[model samples]
Target: MALLEKLTPGSGSFDNREKIQNQAVSQTFHSAVNFVNHQYAKGCEHIDESTTVCDNDILKSLAFSQMLDRRCSIRKPHTSTCNWILETDAYKHWLQQSTGIFWLKGKPGAGKSTIMRFLYNRLRGECRRSPEKGIALEFFFCARGGELQRIPLGMLRALLNQLFRQDPTARQCIREQYEEKSSAFGYGERTWTWQPQELEVLLQDAIVTAAQTQPVTIFIDALDEAGAQFLSGLANYINQLTTAAKICISCRHYPTPPYIPGVEVRVENHNSGDIATFVNDRLKIGYLTEADSPDSMIWEDLKADLTKLAAGNFQWTDLIVPLVGTKIAEGESPEEVRRCLQIVPDKLGDTYRRILQNVIRQEDYSQTFLLFQWLCLAQRPLSVTEMRYALAAKDMVKSPHRIRCHETASFVKSDERMKRRVNAVSGGLAEVVQLLDGDKERQIVQFIHPSVNHFLLTEGLNLLSKLAGDGKELLAHQTSATEFTSNDTVQRCHSNLYRCCLNYLLSEETPIRTELGQVPGGSELDVRCKSSPWHEYATRFLFKHAEEAAKYRVEELDQGIWL
Candidate 1:
């Protein structure tokens, strides 16, 4: 009332007084709008601050160098290969629904991971086009990758990292807990690492906070690769998350995860069309465009047979198609090509065995068997350069009296040459993967696929042992004379690696029992690390392998003397 009285003139002409009153009203209206704008700006600033906090050191601590290795390493779906899943009712319903879980199940090499990648990419595009809808998070399980990539802790870290990045409010929900831990313990990734249980709790809190503003969708591929022990717990936890967000997971048909109520899309049932399309695109039949061409009928029949034989297995189709193309390219008659395709074992396992026996030369059997043993049961995945040193040491171990580390490097092949050697020895079952670690490139050796690893561990190992006649111990499972179980066989593998580690450590090339003087910008230790690829691995994992080898007692190593 006082303000109003002040604004009105005490004595003035009526026209001037009315004009002054109107001006006062106009000024008040503008002031209110400006105040509201100021408050809104402050709110926005707070949100930005929260998001910025989430993007800082705390957030980075949750990530690791190999956290995204499997996810990014996955190959994108071929053109039009995964489109069929989009049109399925199960997929459509899952996408349109507000909240639920979806399961995509398939046999090994049936393209479950590929389909998961496709769906993730589609939702990612949708979110990009209309961000208000929600965000997408993905983690691909890799059994052959580093320990983190195959464990639950890694998955949670990856998902939470995405959630915190997308929703700043979500960061606030867990900030107190994070800070409390940080204060009680200490800072820095080296000092403190998040346990699996702690990560799970934080992930739950983050989802609840984020879901309040928008929906959340998660895609986890190759769940089976995470191992059987974690499957049930992971499924139950995923079920709980469905109440707050949508979840999708892919795994093999066997060792099925505990039942989580959701739509199940069996990839094999719906991938026939995709298989047919792939066959048509890959098979060399376009030149015989004329319906009456001499070879047209044969090519058509072969295409049909390939699709039918594939039985909805994309990997099988992928393998056979190239062989068919190769035969055609060599100017083989249509009948001969068709005959060759027919002989390829319909089952993937048999086909793998055929490949191994047919491609590897007789003289290379022993070395090849050793390579498979190293790949299948090594404590960790070996880099290509490390593998070269490892193989050389295996040869030198036969004559430990003449052990020379310098000679080992001389025998080591270039990365490309070693890659070809691995390919030849494993008969395409193993491959060398080049990865980027910061500014450096790393070449790692692994099986071509999970199924390949599966085969090698079981009947594949038995078969290789028989062909190579490497040793009686290699026949761990099948030999009735020696009643060693599969576990015993694995221990023997460890025993072999242990001996190799010992040989490498004792070599003259090793810089053991020496004080590394600190130099400007680097130390002698740094030089040794660069020059000696196997030295660090041997020292770090030597005792671990010895412990594993202890399970199956080696008669020579039983005595506390150098054999």
Candidate 2:
């Protein structure tokens, strides 16, 4: 009662009010501290208690971490079906299994890449389930970068990087591997250098270790662009890693890196079906309303036209589909669309050349044509950077030896001289020509598809032989004929041209091979030698009267023209 009186109102009441306020403040503080401690304990239950709970401000530190995990998660936009290739059961089966290296070889525009993209999406979904099922999917588009040129290693690194993001245990294993190697390095005071072969083995070991917990699958498109040596190395590596992982490779037929003895899929057989489906899909119900809905007569007619034009090539369909779609977009009648389809160029090279010719200036026509020829004859696809370097190097060689326009005209004093005299063009003229060449490199130095390369290299060489004759005559008629002599550059270029022609004649990778199998008569070499209608033209125009036509290889023919 005495304590209550001391805490009462007025003299005692004022003291009571202060005491009650102090107690309430102390209770509120204790409750807040207890709530925080409880949360801290809960958070530390799974984590080490020795580590301090980071402040709420640490949430800022995790923003980038969340972004890193989700950045690649955006699904690729769905491709329009106007040019979609059908996913066959055979392809689906190959996608599901993580065994052996499957090579998909076909000509350019054959829908190899399209099919690859489709399969990759399907496999990625499968990888999402049971991370322990050993399937981790990663894709490397070769044209996207030079890193892809490293093949299996580049592929393995990409896959492991993606897998590590989702599986902490796998990441820990990788860290442990690195630690063990570092410890070994420290103990021996020696460095470990891994050759491609050794690195492949180590990668296989890591992947197998991971697969024991989860399966991994890798998809590689444009194996041809990766280079033959890299492809061979990849095939060898795939053989070693077959038990734990699978790789799907897509490329053209010419450089089908040594056979891996597994399933092989051809894009040609799928072309007709895929093209038909694509055409039908594009002519949707509204677009086909005239007959019995878009699914009726108009749809069937468009598909039939596309099928005939496609001729077992997916690229043709791809180009034509877009053209038709554009016409439809422009409010052109279905009949107009059908007429355009009928005139769609049958030869891929001719079609590309027509498009290019229309786009470039007429005066630059010959230069562009010659540049394209050079690209077609190149041993491999050169990057835009590489092509630019090559062009600069070529120009550098020409600059020092270039003659003044008047000097060049005076040198060629004959009747032919009047027809092709050099003019005082801008120095930038050469640079502009080179720039145009470089532009092509950026688009991918695929001047023409492999099949077209074969056609041009064969027929093109014969055309060049004729041009060489004319060039030889013009040179002989020049006042400085004695001063001008064939040099290594000229000889080498000519030899390469001849070799390209010879290779095309002898190549076993032609479409007729499956039916002919080197029996000789049915081979390209045999046809060109004995039966081709062009043989008569070549013999009459290029071989007969060789001495009169300076372009003819009289001396070489005398020695024997080997196929």
Candidate 3:
């Protein structure tokens, strides 16, 4: 779609609109759209024959680039967790295997990803200890995070990227594919379609060509998050890879065991000691202090009770123990905190509700809820800076509400101030986490847990509706900013997001020149839009949100958009 955007009919070809005839303009517009559409269908471009560029590096990034540092990265084994997995004979054998897969399976919160990280770090250490291993590649997939993290094309590209980066000479065939794809073949008769099979062949050929004498291992987390077709293809391809390389994967148990020979390592059983240590450390953090307490149970008994309740699932313990500590810190006596823990639901959904109920304001629930809604519904993750501006935008066409934050974003000039505003807007529900994005670093606002997305979509929406009924006026604004659609919570969130984005876009005070040379008054400030992370999201997804919102509230849709 972005490729077609460059060919936008009359945009560049005939820029002097005042000089052009109406009929000519109309003809140019249709021609461009039609030409791009036809090219898109054919998967070809009409660029000059000599305009080819060596773009394999760009192709490698199509997915893998998005995969880099997409999370609050986990770099090592949990401090409280045991390292017995590394010492296990089964795991040791799996790692040493010339070719085959080591599959790690577990329930939702059984610390599978954590274990995967542990293994990845250990493998990295091995590579460092002995340089002959070349490089060990790792990728983590999140069902709730990004399109790249959950799709096959991205995963394949990530693998291909690793192969090319670790050993460039290995991708001779891939190099050819890259050149051919970019070449002006057949005078633009048929465009080169980037099918999954295309990369599959290159990857297979690249791995086959590596002639790696040193056994290398690849850790790919969350196969269950990827498409079934990709999963099956990967399973088959890796079967061939096992002849020289070892592959490891962590995912939720599904689709039965692989028919291909593989090593099965269950994460639940290995996590008991780790879970116990984690819980004990959490309890000792603040909940066990002698300063205040009504509960008489011994520390040992408390740990045992919590450990038993966790039932080999790290996620339940992860949320519950911290929640208890939070409650104790917030003025609830240790005795009262322990009492509440007794009734707190073991399920992840219940834990989320308890947390939200405590922190989410009943009066301004939808506005705050919109923050989470935008994070979940956004086509891509929004950074803390982006969310700050998003939360503050008020639709001018409507009876505009004055939402004055102590801080407002001037994206280029006020990045530091925006961080504080972002935290205020998040209200502790969403948070800013640093991700190691290749050579660069970035902060992204994401929910506490992957499961939080589902909770907000279903139970959380119901709670928002109930809370929105008697919500009070916003102290930050002249009147209450609780805008909610009674029947369509999802659409309302999207619509609100759409309006906010439009307001953000409209709020721009100046435009920049894209001419080859800078204009007299042009500075970095003039090119603020070019530097902002939110610019692309605003440009791409604004209308998508509005389009979706119109599905449920077409009449409520602002006519100003057309204008």
Candidate 4:
């Protein structure tokens, strides 16, 4: 009313009383909107202030870099229905209750992440519709992203950060912990990470604060990826936290979390329809171009066989769907594709083998084996550009120009050749895609699925080695092919990797447009060279990888490599 009075013309009196009243009504509505906007801005400022006290310069670097918006990718649209759980009475009960834990468990490639992502999005949408429901904290664990993304400390900090964004006052517990650590030996004398116990206290404080107004939800996906330590005693923490908040989590079934009273949903039982749908849709987009006109009987037959073979595994569908495209994309009739599908098995291992047999050309066998060996052994997924440079590295014994007065670059600048190399070697098993590392785009090459990772690390590499005809295994897996720990393969792969890295690091650059050591800007030129994707990786990891490799000296390794 005051704002309208200040803005209105001739407030004291109006010659046309009826027109004045109408103008006042419009001004009053505008005044209300202005007040709301002002309050919103003030609220935002308050949140910014509160979060600062909880922030640490180092921990800030460890902040959930891409997590805030990193939803589980179904990869392609309509690929995951993920609605089975929502229809259950248990899910409905948990929603209305709004103060319990729910655990969804599944196998490695059973689309657990997909289901969890769907639920997270659905809950978020509901919150947006009625924000009075309070804030939701969601984090998807990525094992390849390093410790900051897949550990207890990271999880706590991310969860706390999410809560602080919603209720500014909820940061009190974290602020106290920050101050305690800072003041232990004087201000800023010591830096510390929040232990799980301390984090639990802080989480409790946040949940209580948020719950005072409305329900708060926590969604954690890929618990197994966080490692066994995260799994231990996690259920107890969640059980305790849900005393004031609601939580949902999903992980593989091994090294199982503590048994807590909650709705337990097994993924495979609920995913058969979704897997079939995904298979049908994917093939239609990429494979099934021609109709019954070519071979109507087998086309339908292939679809039925594929959906049956899937057996509720989406990863199986992923490998199988592309096989349908191999012949079809080349303008082969549906008859040819059907014949190809006939030999591909329902089992993951057999299917992976078939794909390998197709892509491993007779001549490219050794090259592809070496390429895959580097991939199977890399500590982290190598960028496509990194793989290109790494692939072209020459062993110390193999290089002709061992002694040089001046250094040359590793390989000639050949972007087109590198792309073809990655395409041919990756086959359909690996993906070369643009991923954002912080704010910049990076092109990385990695296995298309976790099953691919398993197969390669275990049977896939061995299969390739068998084709190599040395009858030698690079590394051996335990009783279970999928288990990654306590294996000699790590050493075997690392030694070869060390030699590979060492060579790539030492290889001289052959100057193309610019002369060797030429610089447009002195120190700035060095910084620009440091910016090459491969340059920093080689510089950083060359020694570290060699150290891991040195632990075990393999007889097969070249003596020159020992240098």
Candidate 5:
């Protein structure tokens, strides 16, 4: 009788039970409504406003130098390009899915990175416009960059950091976890490190918790570049996350991903129109855009031929289009340009080798070779200013009589001019990019593509050496420096760099200035960089290069040590 009475009307326990059920239903209904409304809304002015985080230390710790270097370096997709993917059923379905995986596969030099950048930007824009529940994050894997850029651990840390920024609850969870781990390890903030397992668990937890309220989307580029050791496990984990989040990964066709449950889009299959449009726009031929022109058919045919030749390799098209444009500008017939394309090699490596041979003359060989060495083996990406100083130091090292630092004014002229010079010397294999270093902007040099870096390191280096002749004085401290065996090329390069760093540091003419800069509000480091760009790099990496040089024990080091 007492239990029946408690369950009846005016019973406190029954009223509480009914209220709890109603709250659960209401929460579910609101979540569903928010999701559908988000999908249908074509335009929105704000994404979920919860992503902003005030905890600077955690964010800084999670982000590493050069984390965004590769992404920033990618060329923006041309207008009207990469729009085909947005209309695809697979893409639309993936976007609507609460949890899904989308894979974009391509051949090397097929413009996969460019496509990824386009998609990331587009999605980010969409989320920003939608005053709904969505978060967008991206990471571009750079094989030629620091270890963190090419590893799974770095990817996890970056993604988790981004997640914490967007989700306050997750951020609080991270802060608590960080404190607990610090206490357990008895390590100060400086000594604390994030292990991979802990990050993985935290990411899973964050995703699950975040999904209850909103959608999270992540774009990862160049999975093949990310270390192969963890790719299979990583793919599996990502697949599991599809229960709550959406992921898109781009990778080269080879070293195929171990798991294959995701929707796969072959880059070449869908990018032919984009290639044709790019060629037509970039070829610079007359009447190419006029649909009604009598001669337009001829140009269209020409564009088609080049597009077919590209075989979905946009990089190949990019190289050929400019060459064709140059030929046409020089008054060469379209037939001649077509003939030129026919002779060019189909393989990207060979294509690069050919471009290098054509652009680098005998007099420019040593500088070109040295530039490649620096790009391939530097401790970090070189800023434009540092590269200019490096090349200058090389010449000064060769002819000590001219070992004087030029004024900053002289450098200012070369800042823009040097970019052209670098392109000319490197056959467009290396390019300068402007990116943010905290609040400051820096122009750094990197290879046009990772394949270019690989080619130079493996085949291009030896080819340049053979072409330049054996025992050549390549940035030698002394004329009679040691010859480089193919086996010791890497070490010899490091040794040469070590020597250069020493010459740069010990040279009495080279100023390591301490005065405040003319530019107001500049940091001390910025002032130092403006006055002497190479000083910071040479000081920081002198020992690092020296250690690498020790592997071969170059005699140059002994001379450098004494000098």
Candidate 6:
């Protein structure tokens, strides 16, 4: 009975025997496969070894190939003439020497980021071949307002994570460090007790330790967008890590990163060749080519003119290429195209205005103008979602109210009380309101760009003032209406009206300055102005009663100022 049971599939001894046999067959198969793979890999290594290729030779060939590919890929193709001249021998030597921080500064659209991208691609390829000798590279692109507020932490986390991925030992070391210093929250959790300075020191130490295993390179782009204080801190941190790591940073010249006592490369002043090369490459990619067969000759002529107009500015090339290409596709004459390109405005504002005019017509002019104005006056560069949200909110508050009416007397008179009640209800709305209007998903209500704000506040404001008038007429009309008749109501109405006027006049508060002057006698105003409280009411009263108080002819005067 026991022997019969053992022969069956349910017997424990029979199952053990079958398992051992299966394990033995699997091991043999795996061993044969691994041996074949090892032999093939060795053969491949021998072939590579016998090729007699130097690392520099490989690097140079790769660099040239990349440049050629880039030039070929661009629509309005031009030879990358600038690469050789701008990225000079001196700069190459400096990059090779493991400089801690290399700050490349330029104006907007100056091709700083493009050059960085090229360098990053080259370094990344070099790193992959010899992991032990190669540098660990980390890249951070500071987008407009996306994830920028937590810049330092965000950068550190990204860099550390990259390093950890490259080296398992480094990851283990980071884990140990966290466990040693941090509270009981397991590995990878940040310690609350660590101050910014301490955290920076810790990061520097960790990065240096990682570099000891392999060289490390960190690339940070758009430092200006990252905010001034954060950039300053980053510069200091990179300086601290100079002994072990290399950092390449790019930013606009306006808010340059703090002087970190390292190699500095100014893109605008020195990297014109790189910019020209980039423009030429972009042109090669059909960016300057005619789409239709009829305009082939015109496209060629337009390309030549555009190359000159770009003048080593990548932004100019980026803007003009599409326009010229489209015109050429439409069979425009080369001479006509050149003339049009020549007439195009040089400044960013002019370009923006041209684009605006093209997108909107006469009937939609007011909405578009107001949108531009709001963008110009905003505190920060808001996303499309934020801008839409803010606009919708403002519209809600300013929109006219509709009220229900009840029938009254034989005289067919309106219920004055009901009218007043409805008016009061409308007047009591909130200052800032939120609505899911427009594209609900985008939820924009803020300005398009920070520069737009500057433009609106200065040039746009002047233009709008001419169009909308001084606003005095609107104020007078509102004041004379029943809304401001009662003493209790007058103060609130006047204050609200003044606030609205101020908002229109000054998007941001400017410093206030007070001027004192004597008032003449026999004026309709009573200027019993005291110097005690420098309030808005006092300023308003003085200004409002200035004509009337002229009859008094006071020698002394007190003017109040507020921001």
Candidate 5 root-mean-square deviation in Å: 22.0
Instruction: Mark the regions of model 6 whose C-alpha exceeds 4 Å error after superposition.
Output: 1-82, 85-87, 148-150, 180-183, 186-199, 269-302, 334-563
lDDT (Cα atoms) of all candidates against the true structure: 0.73, 0.46, 0.62, 0.63, 0.73, 0.45
Q: What would the TM-scores of all predictions be?
A: 0.55, 0.47, 0.50, 0.51, 0.52, 0.45
Model 4: per-residue lDDT, tens digit, 1-563?
77467457777654576568767877888899999867655533222433323244424623656555446444432544777788877788888886897888865567777777778877888888988776778888776565667677777878877776666667665566665565563544344555767777877887887788778999988776666556666666768888888899887654356678888887766877887787677666324454435465656667777777555567667666777756555677766765665343346676467556643454555556667777677767787667766665633334355622113233435656665565556554555667888999877776555556667776666666556434332221111222223355566556666665556545533221233545445555356346565555555566667777677765545454322
Clash count, candidate 6: 45
lDDT of 5 by residue, 212-275 (tens): 7778888999887765566688778777777888899998654446866768788878999999
Q: Per-residue CA lDDT of candidate 1, range 438-496, in tens?
A: 79888899875555666677666667766776443332122222333455666666766
Alpha-carbon runs more than 4 Å astray in model 1: 1-54, 187-190, 288-293, 342-563
Residue 329 miss distance in model 5 (angstroms): 0.6
- Top candidate by TM-score: 1
Candidate 3 global CA lDDT score: 0.62
Residue pairs clashing in model 3 are 43-191, 99-242
Q: Kindly list the per-residue Cα lDDT of model 6 for residues 1-563, writing each as its tens digit.
A: 64445446656654677668766866888899999867655522121332322222212211211222221232432345335423565457556775467777655555666766666666788788767555655444443334522356555555555565565446545544444443354323333333345446556777767776667787776566555456677766667777888777777653445677656665545645544455455555354443555556645555565555554456656666667556655657677667666433346555334323322233333334434444443333333333332222222223234211111111112234322222222111101223455565322233222333444444543443233232322221222322122222223322323333233222222122245422344221232222111123333432333333343432212323122
Give the per-residue lDDT of model 3 (tens digit) for 509-551: 3332343535447674346656664555665677889888888
lDDT winner: 1
lDDT value for candidate 6? Answer: 0.45
Candidate 6 local Cα displacement, residue 563, angstroms? 24
Q: Rank the candidates by TM-score, best first.
A: 1, 5, 4, 3, 2, 6
Clashes of 2: 15
